[model samples]
Target chain A: MTTSREIRLKSRPVGLPQASNFELATVDLPAPGPDEVQVRNLWMSVDPYMRGRMYDRPSYVPPFQLGQALQGGAVGEVVASNDPDFKPGDIVSSMFGWREYYNASPKALAAGGLGAITKLDTHGIPPQAFLGVVGMPGLTAYVGLLRIAALKDGDVVFVSAAAGAVGSVVCQIAKLKGHTVIGSAGGPEKVAFLKSIGVDHVIDYKATPDVVAELAKVAPKGIDVYFENVGGVHLEAAINSARPFARFALCGMISQYNETGKPEGPPNIIQAVGKSLRLEGFIVSNHVDMFPQFAKDMAEWIKAGKITWKETVEEGVERAPDAFVKLFTGENLGKMLVKLA
Target chain B: MTTSREIRLKSRPVGLPQASNFELATVDLPAPGPDEVQVRNLWMSVDPYMRGRMYDRPSYVPPFQLGQALQGGAVGEVVASNDPDFKPGDIVSSMFGWREYYNASPKALAAGGLGAITKLDTHGIPPQAFLGVVGMPGLTAYVGLLRIAALKDGDVVFVSAAAGAVGSVVCQIAKLKGHTVIGSAGGPEKVAFLKSIGVDHVIDYKATPDVVAELAKVAPKGIDVYFENVGGVHLEAAINSARPFARFALCGMISQYNETGKPEGPPNIIQAVGKSLRLEGFIVSNHVDMFPQFAKDMAEWIKAGKITWKETVEEGVERAPDAFVKLFTGENLGKMLVKLA
Candidate 1:
């Protein structure tokens, strides 16, 4: 027996989510039971932090339950093996996404250390780029710009979803470390895909009428490293274009992920105490100890082409709730995936 | 020649500063102008971070200028010295505060190293407790709780103007480091002076209408060191009662420092990214290297009585703008001086 179809959750989103709040269903596996491991899925992921596991509260993971089967980040393969660390065609990666097939018990798919299961090598890359650029949004833009905004040397960074997928790997790692990068995003094709990567300054927060005066007319001697993926008014334009001691790095906000209520924060958050600012907030599974030096500096910055990525996909598994309602309608630009073979 | 009088800034406030925006003037002091010293004033400080140097813009200290003379934290005595490291009477301490004395030049009052005019060994305490609790609101509550909320060890904390003067020494140093604090302020005499110091939950934010459901009903196992001094809605009840890796610190906000406009922040500031929190923002002269371990642990926590302080004065130099507008009507509770003798 084999079956599998999955999807579930059929009701939880109270804000911007509705593909009838999902529900595909079908299941039936069988033969594997001892130390299990069946697998199948191919590519899954569709973030915006799964809208905070559809809100039943108490966060930092655990919440998505309802009719079940929703988890995320996928990339599979194994197809039967009594699990001697996976076998039949290997290729792992889990969190056990909105299914297509699953069996588990490889220690329950490697219990939550970056949602474990782990087995892919993909040195040639593209195993759905391990559910996005070197995975988990390139270790969340390398642990929020080198260990939560500690990225020094002339920091001027600023990011705010600069063309998605962990703000396009934090605008190509703050333009490959030479710093000075700014990038907000919304239209004009994610502002020409953040000026085709070298970013240097690209607002277009939907043709700005004031993203804090277009980030003070292009960071006039300010910003010292924000990152924060799109919170309200881009976190009040990075606390009104900070400078003295600025740091930020909050990571994900996706504009209040469909706020039903409490969502109007950042009115110059008291210019973070006259600009001593720090901010922080993080969670890429609490920095999976920077995954083997973020898989060796993202495989040498994607083989020296200095990293680049973008994927919208949405092919099967019932278009995975239309690729998570096109990540709250910015209509996906950098990594939204679904494929699910 | 000497005649002092001072005060100044007769025009700059637009929001809550009315006392016709201050002014008194008189001037006419000129004695030791060479390696100067002179002093005289007796106890000044009137802070809610001196309403952020009466806002004119560029912050972290410089602003209050208008017609001049308004720097803060005083406590004088020297009365003439031409400097060989002060002598006349010594007892110093100075930001050259708002009036009655002046001579300067100890390298321009120690060039902004904690508003320099040093010389004060008030070890037996009270020379205005070096301008409130061993100075600079007790080193801004010991560098915002042991170095910007790095407090740890079963942390709980909370704070928010817990009866002022650097939140009553950050609620007795998080209840003498045993933790579980809470505090908030306003009314019922600063909630019975934070239940006479041993605070382990006090709140009263103007008899709560719902300070995030009264900080989730007195931190039901939440807060892990907030201390943010009263920003709107107490920074939305410390980001809705943070917990997971919480931290905060952010020294002052005095409820948005008499907001003339841009305020409204902290509507659950995106629960600081699912509670990984951190916040930060500080400025005790950028941690004057924790001022000799905060004046030797605040003189052994005020000589083992485990710390306690409250002032409110307002005697002369013409009620120093009514002690800086009774610190915006919460009507001063702990350290709000003025005596200027």
Candidate 2:
């Protein structure tokens, strides 16, 4: 029997997720059925949004099925194929969950559209980027910035979680379009990291007490677009810095995700009406048509050495739970990825 | 010397204005300095927006000048004139501040714009209609309801301060456009008034403990457009009932004007982002082009008896301030006007 290491939900945790919230287990890979294929996961992605999945609550998508493997977008190779479309040695991607090996069928991830059995074409680019810079997180930043925020050239942009996967790319893309981009991270190192990647300005919220006053110092003209990756006080600062008719793109609210109780809401919504602002919430799946175009543009930027990124790779599949929990405490330097060996 | 009574701003009041705020003083008439005409005021209009004039703050319009007469649009007759454009005994509307008799010059209220001197036309409509049904209040309601709210033919519309001047016309216009209109007022009397004006639903917020729940019962489709006149709780309830992509026309927030302190803001502004709602603020001056069109439509609606309204006329200029205060307490019905004899 082939052995596979996996991380499973131990118990639904309240507030911040800790070590005891996750449990590691070993399981045998089942023989593939007529239409199923066996996937051997190589690279697994860990994201802040996964914290929402850990809890048993309704969101845009369903919560994690407790005692089941924690699933996420994964890049892997098919070990054996029973389906005619997918053959052995074909590189594929699926929400394969947090496991080293699994028996997956077309019904598991692909239900006819951009299905689970995607042909991973490296096209000479780094493959890990598909999990971060060019995958869901990348598209999240790109689609939200362009469609929802209506980003224009020379417009100023501010992103929360500025050094994180999606936020870092948002800063770079806004910069490529000739807009001034500012980013905020919790500590000094990440702030420096964002600055190194050509971010026009960086503010470590730990050092700045008054976000509105601080943003005024950086973007005296006020923010034209706000890429919201974190919510709460950061949201208030962004809202206050917004000029008339400014657009805000809501991708995620990481700050409120781990809270045990309901967090305080913004009380200055009248400013939105006064400033004639528009704030829109969006999901990456809604804009799938732009992927082919995005892949082309991003590939060119990478070739010209204009685009760069960093990934904090946690070694071993058994340590995946540790890597997932480290994201909450800001231990991640860039896109946090778990490499299965 | 000609005798003309006026309410002069002797001093700015600390809070809710009192008699001490005004000084009724008569001075010798200064003869028309070139291009000036003397007006014998026939009727004056009292409005809620006038409250902004009482404060010393920067707003869309300049605040009332201290130690000077309160300025507003007044309908009167040009009793004496030296300008070639005007003749004696010609009825005109001028921004002739708070006084029974005043002089208008080329450099008057608007200096070089429409407000300098507006000759009243009797297009089979009463001159008083210029202040009520077809004037600033009516125009405000029309512009806000149509341009900002974009009220659809079958859309459900909820207007606050339904018994007030602007809101009364909004409901009539909305009803004529085939909308299921709902309105909120303070008491049963005003509730019945809304029903008389063809509002499909009326909620007496005074009788209901939970306005959001009451609105849910009456407006099953959820409010598509909210014509916000009195803000505060009504605004909160509107936010709760706001349909996805709902439109809010924030014309005024009279409910918070006389508040002892800053009124607590709405609790569910994030719902705006969640539902992709659009809230816009507007003034009638921005939509002056609609006058000739509104003049025709309003006249047609009035002739067909499809639109009806109410006005609480306070006779004598001395009662104008009292009538103005009545609005804050929801005491007056329909448009509030002052008749000078």
Candidate 3:
């Protein structure tokens, strides 16, 4: 018998969740049943969607139960296994919770849990990269930009949360595609990080009094595809800057995730009619076909040194709660990682 | 030479326009210049879009001149022609104003003016029908419902302003394609008209307090395609009823046309993102290929007596202003028409 360190839901948060919303505890672990793999988690992914899991309301996925161990995407090594597909010593990733160890079911990723996807290939890149540039959010940016936005070369792209895991990848993809990429972030550091990734224009809406005026100067031709990672004021700004036939790809509403039940109604969709615009919302899991392509291309990009990434590591499973809370405040940069023994 | 009776703009209204906003006067017809055609107007279409012309702001089409004659689709016999494609006594339709006669420049309609497209056959259908049921609004319904919405047969369709010019035709087309069609109208009379055209379900939202609840009873599966001819409360209701992958074809915002500038925003577009919906706004003019197909199918529907239509005809060019305002009040049973000499 072994004990798995876990962080459970302690309280429902009002705004950007704090450490008080979670509780770090230990639970007795049962040995792996047949067709199950026992994993010793090394790193966990901190994402915006976790905010929804704490609420009781019906969302894309089920809400986490109070005092129950919360689960999401985590990279771990198989300490023991009874499954034919998974063997001991193999590094596997689970869309499971903030636990130091977990017993992952043999089923496909879809049935595993929230944010669960197909088995990821950690061939050329570091295992923690699966939590950052090679994981769900990265694939999300790729599919949302290339397929959903139907982005064309020279098309202008405007991404919200420009230095975020998904937004950072969106900026790089936009740059690689030869498009004029502009982004908005909270502070000077995040804005500077966006510029570091080859973003053509970065606006620290905090420093810039008029976001519209700044975007207008950088993107005189206007935005073609707006990759919306953050909602609220950023969305309002994108709406004002959108060009004719502009497309707003609704990927994440990170800014509005803390709202009681759904975000407040937007002021004008009627503008869509006049501009002949197309606004579509998409879930990353819906684009299943793109996974193989994402893997191949991402692997190639990493091998060719075409891409570089970062991880904000929080040591020990007890620190997972703090790492998760800091995600909302721009406290941690790049992909926030929770490392465990 | 007879003076043409024309309706010119007098003042822009604050909300719903009134008769005082128009100035009807008789003016001498100018002789046709080179590449010009003089047409004795037969039928001029007075549509909901004319309300936008009353404002000075830019729209998909140019704003209606404050002191100049407001124009729309009109079919008439050419009295004289200096252009090669048009001849005297030939039936032609172009962007002619509310007048008994108009001298149109080829530059007004570039390429070939009224002569560029096929003349109205008006065989099985009435010539006035060419201004409506088989005309601009019909094609608007077609493209918005079919091409942009990418409708699949048997999909549930919900239409707002269900008995108006555009909604009336859209319901019938959806029904013919084996779809379950639902509609919401202002009053019992209009709701009855919606059912007469083969809509499966009807909700008089003005009579029903909760639109979402009312739609929920009938559309347990939720709405797949929302043909939005009206926006506002109806738009909010549609968002709540929208199924995953719902498509909202925004052919018009007749609900907001009376406003001088940008209309107030609908409160439910954020739901559009949550539900993974696509909202597309377009004008029928952009989907021109549907014309020949529309002419063929509409003629067949007329010949087989597959269609029954109602017209609120305001006699003469003088009554165009009242007729236009009556539309905003839902006074018309089907299409609001203005007949000219």
Model 1 pairs whose backbones collide: none
lDDT of 3 at B239: 80
Question: Candidate 2, residues B99-200: lDDT per residue as tens digits?
Answer: 788876744554534365777676777677778887888888888898888888678999999878899999999998888998998898888889888899
Provide interface RMSD per model, one decimal.
7.4, 3.6, 2.6
lDDT of 1 by residue, B49-144 (tens): 777777787776778879887888888898788778778877888887878788887777576787788888886777987888789888888888
Pairs clashing in candidate 2? A71-A97
Q: Candidate 3 — which pairs collide?
A: A71-A97, A72-A96, A72-A97, A265-B267, A267-B265, A268-B265, B53-B64
* Candidate 1 chain B: worst-modelled 10 consecutive residues by lDDT: B106-115
DockQ of 1: 0.30
Per-residue lDDT of candidate 1, residues A166-205 (tens digit) = 8888889778878889888888888887888889889877
| Among all candidates shown, the one with the greatest lDDT | 1
lDDT values of the candidates?
Answer: 0.84, 0.79, 0.79
Which of candidates 2 and 3 is the stronger one according to TM-score? Answer: 3
Q: Mind listing the fnat for each candidate?
A: 0.84, 0.19, 0.65
Off by over 4 Å in 3: A11-20, A107-121, A261-263, B31-36, B81-89, B105-118, B260-264
How many backbone clashes are present in model 2? Answer: 1
- The number of the candidate with the highest TM-score is 3
Task: Quote each prediction's TM-score.
Answer: 0.38, 0.83, 0.93
Please, what are the lDDT tens digits per residue for candidate 3 over residues B1-341? 65888988889877998888899988987688888888888887778877776778767677877888888777788888898877888776676748789887655566643234335556646777777788887878888888989899668999998888888888888887889999988888888788778899999987898887888888998999999878877787788889989999987777887665655465556666667899887867677877789878877776776666778888899988888888888888778877787
The DockQ scores of all candidates, in the order shown, are 0.30, 0.29, 0.55
Locate the minimum summed-lDDT window of 10 residues in model 3 chain A. Answer: A110-119
